[model samples]
Target: NLPFSFIFFNGASRLYRSEDFGKTFTDVSKVLKNYYIRKEFGINVGPENSKKVILTADVSKLKAGGAIFRSSDSGETFEFINLPFHPSQGMTFHPSNPSQLLAYLTGVLCCLDDVNARGNLHLQRTTDLGKSNTKLHTNIYSFGFAGQFLFCSVIHNQSLPRSILVSVDQGDTWNEAQLPPVSHEQFYSILGADNEMIFMHVDEPGNTGFGTIYTSDDRGILFSKSLERHLFVDSSGANDFTNVTSLRGVYITNVLDINNTIRSVITFDSGGEWRALKRPSNSQCDKTAKNPEQCSLHIHSTYSISQKVDVPVPPLTAPNAVGVVIAHGSVGDVISTLLPNVYVSDDGGYTWWKALNGPHYYTMLDSGGLIVALESHPDRAVQVIKYSTDEGQCWHSYNFTNETFMFVGLVSEPGAKSMNVSLWGYKQENLYKTTWLSYTIDFNELLTRDCDERDYVLWLAHSTDFGSRTDGCILGCKERYQRLAKSSVCRNGRDYELSKEQAFCQCTLADYMCDFGYYRVGNDEKCVEQSDLKDKVLEFCLKGKEEQSGSWSRCGVERIVEGQTRPQGLGLD
Candidate 1:
């Protein structure tokens, strides 16, 4: 059973906690008797432990600022945090450590009144549940953590070149990153692939029409330009940047290509190179098209979600993952077409096939092991539901009910990688009355056993016809094979039943990582340019030979290895 869920809504400051999933509610607003609560409030639950809940609201309708109340034990009691400035909606909690919080300090500079009150966002950090707070940075636009490093972008600094600040020891010390030459760059934010790689979006200097994505592998110490294009950034909230990379290192982002058009691009090797995804097979392209590669398609983007702009478009309300894509695209220039048939991409958007040829609500479960869809066409009542275990290659059908209902959404746990899914909609029993209902399904009871050989197929870096696959061709200097599966996994950590063929890969560009003091700039062959080599040092090898030219050889120089091999499972530098 779940612990508890709380809500404060309906134009009332009344707080309610439900232990039985809305069966009955307990009013916990009394815990905040010390300070007056307001209808406008921001509530957050501790990411690690749900019991730790916190809220912020104006102290009173006539008060100048607001008060923050935090409760370590759900809503039974609340402790008011003493801070100088009012906390804004921008609050970030450490992922693993729930007690630490970073919130934007507001309502200070020119607030004079709640309305027409504008103030600079000063970043504040607290580790002791707001008992004490420290102002870390001022006028910071956004902040996120990569490994142990904390990054914040400085915005609206007229005296200084706008820059990003990094803190190695939490917020104790901060340093500006040695970013590549940038100019007239308007946006500043960070994108991380799970917490290891940091992708920075900035405008390259002397460039007029495009932006570049620079990456840092060792936190923010060294950097390299990974990709350059008019990459799409989601305007969901105040965040100037959003992530397109998934857990399996599959990146799906719409880029302005061919004519500054929205062509969805994907990359399997970090950002070494990117290729535009083909349009769905069912959509007819123009007959005059020279080739399929030049054909343009409008890729569906996860639109403004925090503002709830498109409630019917699914919002992708799921964590980014690999092997399954609920892509919405039209033949050409369908920017206004919000809904199309569901296009499935199992091979990381290399190719796509239409699975559902209508407007629909979609969700993925078990890291794309299961795909669910409910038709919500404008003219039709929703009843039929379809699901697939093999990434939409095949499907099984189920009816919603004997009668049709208005499809609201398909719901599931995001990033939890769970097998539970829920179907939600409103049933119209009479012309004047409607009933909201939700039916949940636990796949544990339905999926009886593990998948078999039929669930897997040998996967490669690129697509190939029956006989077009090249043997031992240097494609990203990858391992022998990639096993893609419709099933989550087999005992062998992959569901592909085929045997791996042995092949020794030559030292391709992928095998050689960026050299010290140098970084790659859209160039994959070698790390040919210098970055901020911040006090970089070299270690003595078995005493150093071939790479050590001139009289710097401590060991034998005859026939010694000169090349360095990239470590297994490292991202493209």
Candidate 2:
């Protein structure tokens, strides 16, 4: 089990560490000082040292920020690691080396910016924990580790299709990995599994609702088509198969027939072969007068004859277990009354059993074969949260007295203490005000008692830092985006404007005048004029073309010159 885990709380302004599972937490914000960790970038733990935590902070003019911090002695203390670039995203440590890190310098170009400005996006690699770094590539969409090999999906040129590149020598050199002939322009979901197996799902062109799944066992050196159909693989949430074994992987497809019933399939041999799973039967529904026989008895025979049933695509799979769960209803003239609300298949999707009788949203926990179900009813004021172990063979329900608590998600750490889960929910106190809350539950203690008799302690905390008054601001604006007062107007470009009604607004330069509290950092980008710039800082500037002269200004940074054709590594000392 994991010895310790860290959580970013209070809107990532504060960090906490828990050694005894979710029992208690100690504020480790002092180690991070005044820098607020960027929750979106994610906090990474050292592969070798669980206590060695890495987190990135937002860079501002006032604070000494925009750097990565590492805690060698857990959260007690931290040391700053020099980053070649600021505002990095997707920071990941090597699976075998804690000192190796990979991150992309993002936010270098805005959405409205030209594609040529994309050269600023650099995928950097560091093997000595930021002591030195190398620019691996540019325009990287995503990257992950498959064993000792590092894989990256990058789009070198906007006109060309994205390429899959692999680096086996700790990102020192890269080789183009062979991918399927599917359109490389579409979005791809790449996952690395155990035994050096890499799986990728390339979306088909057009809205065919089908994609091709490719598998590579040679560490992405060669890939072969595993499945080519309308396969719906549950790759989101906690069920991600990136770092897990491919034996328990499950996906959904349709049996070729006139009716084309959706079928759940499981692959245990790293997607070398797949076997269709049987649909679950409901004995309770069979005993009813309307249906006096077992549903499986009739359904299995009918499936053999008609080869059609109303089964939805993409059956939900358990996070770490060999389980496949699905829900469906009758379609067209087929009046099948024996169908249960939910069916679950364990044992690598070989057999199945009716799990639940009513509609509910299912969420599989990371451990203990646990799954939670939230009631799906628009009219219901109070909803029930159902917990089940043993692959949903039995379930216990807990009703929420607070009607405002809406289920959001479950947070569980890999290799965490078993049966320790945290439930996130959104609480709307009123129409205008909303809050995010979380409840940490220890299932081992709660499952010991009966469903009704169980009285477990729920440690409640604010998932979002609502108490913080500081709001986010953009480059050209020094006032908090939420601030109602406007001090200055834009002379060259339009001042970024935000209304009280809009939750978010984009600030773009129509002309070049800096708003109050902000000044032109270089020639283009604006920063807080009052910020303490003690060292040399890279600032975004505007370069005008000869023809467009005063008519157009290209918003770019000094590092990205106007006519530079190649990406240059940032000089960091």
Candidate 3:
């Protein structure tokens, strides 16, 4: 059950741990705390050494102004290994040597252990691991040591995409990988898929549609085949493309397989070819601004390299089955809602299926193998979370207690032990998490109930409760159908049949509800109900109603109190 592991998070101190994978952890904060305020990158664990564990960390910029930490005693403590010339963006341990290490710093590069630091781009040699180093080049963004070649992605400018650079000589000059058509303009991010393959997600100039792909056959150079449609959006692009799996490069269409020389680029072949590779489709760049229910292709990768952009939906298919109902800020398609009655296909946009209907609120692929769907029903006092392990065939339900919500989103930030998933409410403003079942979200303490004019809750709450604040009551009046459905009779308390317009009048009080024999019914003046004719007659009786025959109708025959013969019409009438 434990998976040969243990894990912990102090919450207060922000300390975390996991056991069963290694015997000990080493810390190196002492060497790093002198430079920056805190660290950005955290500790990394390696294999056992002398009954001790190896750990690495990049200090938060606030703690020591950008330093790295290494630990050896299972994270109980740590020590400084060495400092490079500049702050490091990434770090890794050498496969053969215990002390030999590689670190990448912003604007500078180094391969060091405990004594010296050097390297600009291609390679930085360390005779004693961290003991000594030298600068090789100046244009590299990230580097990795694989086989006989030292590989790197180089960028002329940070705003521009970096090309793949490789060096046969250790820490010496490097040459750019020359592919075709796709230039540095198309290359945005690069990741070493494995020891042999390098994967780059291409981005275009203005960030429009899918970017292409280029493969490295030998090492970094000699990239062949301008693999079109393999492009992904960067962080800025991801903002517009809301789906998480898209930016992470987990789409089904974007393939990263190797056949000795990394041939067979699928996306470049055709949209049809990309469709054939579909398993569970990965998220892709969304073309439309307001269609999130549409399912896009999602890809999965074994290597820990950064993810590519969201995958696109194949062409000429039925609309997405993301369903008709949608709650704002809900996760899933984050784009168009595909048709409800359609099936998935595998040969590039030519496919079909009649699957389950999609929910509008929060949706998560749960660790328990279920896809949990949450809805925006505030009157229920809790948001509903439904789970479906077998895609959408069946579902189970869980109510999120102690929180008022309408829509939800689940996302994660990488952690020391495991990934952390944060549950975000659309209108709630406060975020929550439940790594353990007994999850306590101190959302009340973190959220302010003060209604802001610009806040989303201004429109989402129930209308009867609008203008008057109450817990779990969303703004705006309840929908007409919902209010009518809850009543005992067809017309609620009235015996009259209700029309959509009439229901709207009774609830919201529109002006046109007045008629000839009816009176304006509700306080807001929208509905009409029959008035009592008898009450009107009684009130007019003393005034003497005119007879139908045009004769005067006297009140008590000219009141006999005076006993004088007065004109009949002059008595009290």
Candidate 4:
């Protein structure tokens, strides 16, 4: 797979390209025009060809006019493409055909006189990258391509039930599929992993109302309800039904009951049978709470679940893992202070475990690894990044010093071994700036680690190219390289900082020598700095150092005794 990656920075109105697995990025904003790109709608790269990429931008804040831009040479340059409609949304390319593209134009008037047209919202298709266009369908709320068939949820009118339309000839002709019995208040459909199945959700309003989810195995020909009555109490209603479906007919949904409790359920046979997931336990809260009722474990919709901050909440199923699901409790709760903030379930949401604590956002890498960026503590300003390989059973932490950035989200490159970490930052009055960082940890590497001291050091050294075994090292070397690379004083040693700064300062070898802020200790053959050494040690303990009493230790190491257990090679040997 190609190493090329691109990210749009909303605040700067620019795009960046990273060819080295997101380890480094170069400003590629020249390829884009002066228009503001829509990051929310997303940038599309051709599935079959990484060289072919497309982007959409708004001419003005009012969305007066819009433009589509294309790059044929892997984002080296871009050219403007013409669109039949302005202010469009949901830009997508054909699954197999790079030449074919589809975009949804909702609430945009085709003609000023046709304001009353029922088909005001229509889908436009193009085979030549927008040189011309053909209208595909109207009144479409959402559309997706699964294998060769294209599925769309169309709303004809309020009085009529919303229909699920399928097109087998690549949007040429459409047919309505039979669905379950439910009110047409709203309908949403998404294609399963392949085109073999489709999942639909219908919302019914008013009392005695409930949302019904259906599954279609015959390419949207016929649908059947997947939920059983016993899952919900008699006469009890449900709302806020969110689901994710896999290619193997595994479906997961988050249902909020009338009593405000949120239950996560999963079905393996396309909803033929369902199992409710168990809420993660809070042992610390149970032991310390005054009221026993406050210690009970349950997932509630209102204050129990964490509201998504800047980044989008993670879906039920890991994008890369078949049956894994990660969930967390809400922030700003008294009971949450004694509970882990994150939980994970590997058996399709049947069981759970407390993974980590603190405010953070996480995403699953294409390699089935999980990455999280969390605050050092609930009250601290420092943010640290953590990685979990064994499905969140244990984690390794990395702290970025001198970098003021917020975690945006993680990007999984299709068919690639590495994933890109998107972060946002600001520089004096502009708080919307963004940057892309790469995590080069491969799935194989994570699988081989034993989580021991030697394995940890080896992984850190190899992944960040830190110092040799004999030399001192910088904790979070990758992040340090990023922060120092941006400084005017340290820009000269950017390459060395990234690859060689972790080792002893070899003043004799110019290429392998240490950067600024590092000095060689006389006659010691090693680079040493009083301030950096303290920072490195402090970082080590801040990342879950253990004490002799079998208790969790942080920010400091306990005194070591003969035959007592402690981290080997402490104090940098």
Candidate 5:
């Protein structure tokens, strides 16, 4: 019983056979001659006879395109299955039947006789594995099976109605699937699976507004919604297609406006409820404290004395929430890099935990504990990613020879064996397989190697450590100072060397503090920074009192209130 084989395209398309479940492989490139530009490959271990094989190749030998190669006798010989030349994105064999095959080109899915092609979406099916061609659809970006039906979405078209549609009885007809109200722009990056659920990410239009996640069950007929408040700017905020693992009823998509905001990655639960895998909120308070509001004072006052000292203050706008978060897996709970150091919520955007100590960029498995991370350090050009165990209480690091973009990604599998830490591209080719170790034991051994030959190592610990602590919340005249100190300036500072606990605390505080001109003058810690004059008043009031070395009377109104306060009048002006 051999495991799956692996193939890749570096300078040219190359093939390899891994006899030991991807542990070791021997090059079989000699068999694939002139395999220049490879698009995609599909392999199916024959059911009846394990030796029987079928290989589809997108040999980009010519500028226009390449050829699809098929092999039956264990790669000993090959025959070219002549097909139309176009970039192929996916190819697969039917799960129930080995003889049935399907492949997707840029705009078409072709089969033997039944060709259903639209101007936009292309859907195809083959009764006799790559023997002939038939086009099914050409309207949707991508689609998949949904029981006896098909589900999919229209490709990138801002004008098109951003909606998921379903087709029963092959590609003969179509109907819009039930979905929550969202802008059409969000429809660009839609995908579906066979599992009867679809997820869509929607980016709203506005100045720094959040996006929404929409999910559907019953083959995209009805939908549920979840709001995501943070904006993630990755790949133009498009929903990444790499996360979903299920097919049929389950599909995924992310939404954002034209400005491109990575709002949220959501998944549909078994109950048909839209579950947010990652959600950001303005929740920074001591959970155990009976009265967390007692931590701060928000006194909203406006004393206008234009011969009218009894004037009242105007109404204030509601406080806005804060915090930024990104989900790791396809439909995991929302995790925040804000306070309690860092927090994770497994209950699909319901409750949260103060899981870690620092704001992390990469969170995965390592030799010791789970890894939480922080942003890259300017000094350490090579070491950007970091890992932590015990829920981000501590961390270990490794420095790659090359700068792999600092981030955390799932290991493209479950069971927590190992995870991908980063993705790197070289001048000659792209290195996507490189990964980081999840187990603490594996990481310790990985470090013992030369650790420099590879262009990039995508593991959990190869990055640096980010020591952090503290829940981010502060209220007072010195809030900015408190915030700056709580941020990387303090967490990554020379003082305590940015212990993971300290970093987490600082991040929490920084997240909840003011920006200097406005204050959260309410009972809630929801506040803004004081204005310069107010700050000056606060600064001088505190300074004058200390300088006078006495009570308010000794400090005197002239010295304490006159020069220090923003307004210059009698008692408070």
Candidate 6:
């Protein structure tokens, strides 16, 4: 949430700021009185700390570049971070620290397709608020952090066949993550998830044709193939990848089989395992002759870091999301008279129930506690915005505007934490004229109260039992087990705290990740060490090293070449 009530609006010639959470507004445009606001602009604030704010926009300047205005007092005053170029992307503030920022000094773009015009980019950062800067890299494809590790994917020499360079020492030194060898045609980009886990989808030819999902729980030391031909999409050059794993580390994907039928699958243990979701028990059409049946479901697209370019990708969803998910599909073998509708699932896609009778452009609000959608009809004017606080089973409608408007998009600000929704679209004044406007719907004013007991529901994880672990458990308990949490919450749910105690899980792989080049076989408890581990695995795996601090700080390099002598304290014996 915002410490100040300042709500900033771009694209209106002048920028507006409201401190009252969009309740009221003031013209803060005078702060940047010297330049014009370009269509591409960014406004960033600290996540949960000081009142530092940054506003960057392409301004009409003498040098024909963008301007970045920084404010330490929450926009009360402003200063400039003079740069030769403006970034198309936003300033990424540190998750905990505000004074620190990660930004790129990119070159100018002549047009939308100026893919190469990013101007020999310098990925830089400023820790002392522009007093000093450090260039992290140049011409990187993308970069992100996993726990203490920093990963930057780069298309080598500005070409295909990218590599994810890892920096374990705050970018002081870098090494390439030993990902599965990929072909030139294969586009392997990282997937999004929570915790210190990495998921990558490498495109390969197969009947499913989705791509192979490779994962690294040990933070880029090595990767093992997890799910093949699963649901994966690189929304903005792979930024908005996957169904954007939700509140409980849940990943939902629609696996399109050779029959062109999509079966919904979800993974709770990262992509280590996957299970098909049962069709909504009460689905109206329940036939199995052709495609588009109850199993022929489609899901929403979620984002990790969305690029700000215009691309005809799936509808984007960022949402300070949670586990409550929604899908749209039919129950009948669609060779018949079956139509698709919205279905709701609270327990990570194990079971689902119908929510909306028709396809709708929907999103989760109130932290996955409420579901809201604009009925998806491209040719008609939208009159009502519907929402469901009792999960997706029941919904209520709110007229966002006095008259119908042609819907372009509905977006909930990432962390505003308010029911305030901004709906923008075209209001045709006549056959010859249409005006664009936005309506701010503060659901706090529309609804009577928070969800009550009738909306309270319970669901349990289907894959909580870890009977077989490759990382043999304490070596004493044989019939190891896991505590399955039957999560129950009101319409507005909260995460149930599970027992920290691994009650009965014995000799299970739950306690340990397959050590270094070792991985557990499918549903088996034995950790199978890769015979070719020397070539691409850890050079300082804890299990293989004598100096084991259980951290990567004390690490070594992998120099396992054929017919070469092993380094001291680093042999495959």
The candidate that wins on lDDT is 1
Candidate 6's residue-wise lDDT over 1-573, tens digit each? 332222335533465665654545577667776554443444577765436777665554346455577877777788876654555577677553456776654544553255344325556667865546788887665566644566776665545566667665557677666576443345666665333556767766432347766666444656665666554443333322345344234566555455654455565455545665565777644555444434533343322113222221243223333345665544543212234466776545656778777667776655665567878766888889998766566778877676868888776655424567766688889899989766667776554454554443332233333444423222112111222212323323233222222223322233234444555566453446567764453454322343322134222222221111222222212
- Tens digit per residue, CA lDDT, model 1, 1-573: 222323445434667664543334577766765344543445677777777777775544344445677887767778876555556564557764677987665535464444323224567788887667788876665567755678777656555556677776677777666465333335544655334455666753443334666665444544455666645443332221323333234565555455644455565555555555566666665443445445655455554233333324532423334434565555553232444556676655656777776566777766556677777655556777787877787888887476666666665653525566666667778999998766666665556566556655655533344354343233223323334365544222222233444343343454333433444555455555343443434321221222221133212111111112432332322
What local lDDT score does residue 264 receive in model 5, on the 0 to 100 scale?
31
Candidate 3 least-lDDT 10 residues: 317-326
* Preferred candidate (lDDT higher): 2 or 3: 2
Query: Would you estimate the TM-scores of all the predictions?
Result: 0.70, 0.56, 0.41, 0.60, 0.42, 0.69
Task: After the best TM-score superposition of candidate 2, give how far the Cα of residue 412 lies from its true spot, in angstroms.
Answer: 4.1
lDDT of 6 at 104: 58
Clashing pairs in 4: 306-330, 467-502, 467-503
Native RMSD of candidate 4 (Å):
22.9
| TM-score (C-alpha) between model 6 and the true structure | 0.69
Off by over 4 Å in 5: 1-11, 16-25, 39-66, 69-80, 92-102, 106-121, 127-129, 138-149, 153-164, 168-194, 200-214, 222-237, 240-573
How good is model 1 by TM-score?
A: 0.70
**All candidates: CA RMSD (Å):** 7.9, 24.7, 33.2, 22.9, 23.1, 8.6
Q: Pick the candidate with the highest TM-score.
A: 1
Instruction: Give the Å shift of residue 173 in candidate 1.
Output: 1.9
Q: Candidate 2: global Cα-lDDT?
A: 0.47
Tens digits of per-residue lDDT, candidate 3, 1-573, equal 011112222311134332322222233324333333222343445432432233333344334233344555645464555555444544555544445556665542223242122222434544443435666665565566653456666667655545556665554556655432234445444433323333444565654445544434334443322245442444433312111111111123333223211111222111112232221332233354233443443322211112221111111111111111111211123222332121222112222222234322333221111233444333443455554434344446656655544333443211111112234443334456432222222222222242222221111112324345331111111222111111111111112221211111111112011221223221232223234432233221111343121023222111111101221222223
Please give the distance, in angstroms, between residue 460's alpha carbon in candidate 4 and its true position after superposition: 32
Which residue ranges in model 3 land beyond 4 Å of their true spot?
1-39, 42-66, 92-102, 108-138, 141-150, 154-163, 167-176, 181-188, 201-210, 218-220, 233-273, 276-392, 399-573
Alpha carbon deviation, residue 190, candidate 3 (Å): 2.5
Residue-by-residue lDDT tens digits, candidate 4, 1-573: 234433446554667776655556787787676566777766788878888888886654234445788888877788987565664564777886767987766455535455333334677788888777788887866667766678777767756666667777788777665553234533344524344455555554443234555555344544444442112221423232333321133455555456543445555334444555444543333344454443333332222233323213444453334335565543221223333356665544545576766435666653343444454332333446676656677787766444544334444455322444444332222557444333443333333422222221121221223354423222111111111110111111111111122332211211111221232342232434436333442221111342121133231222221111222333421
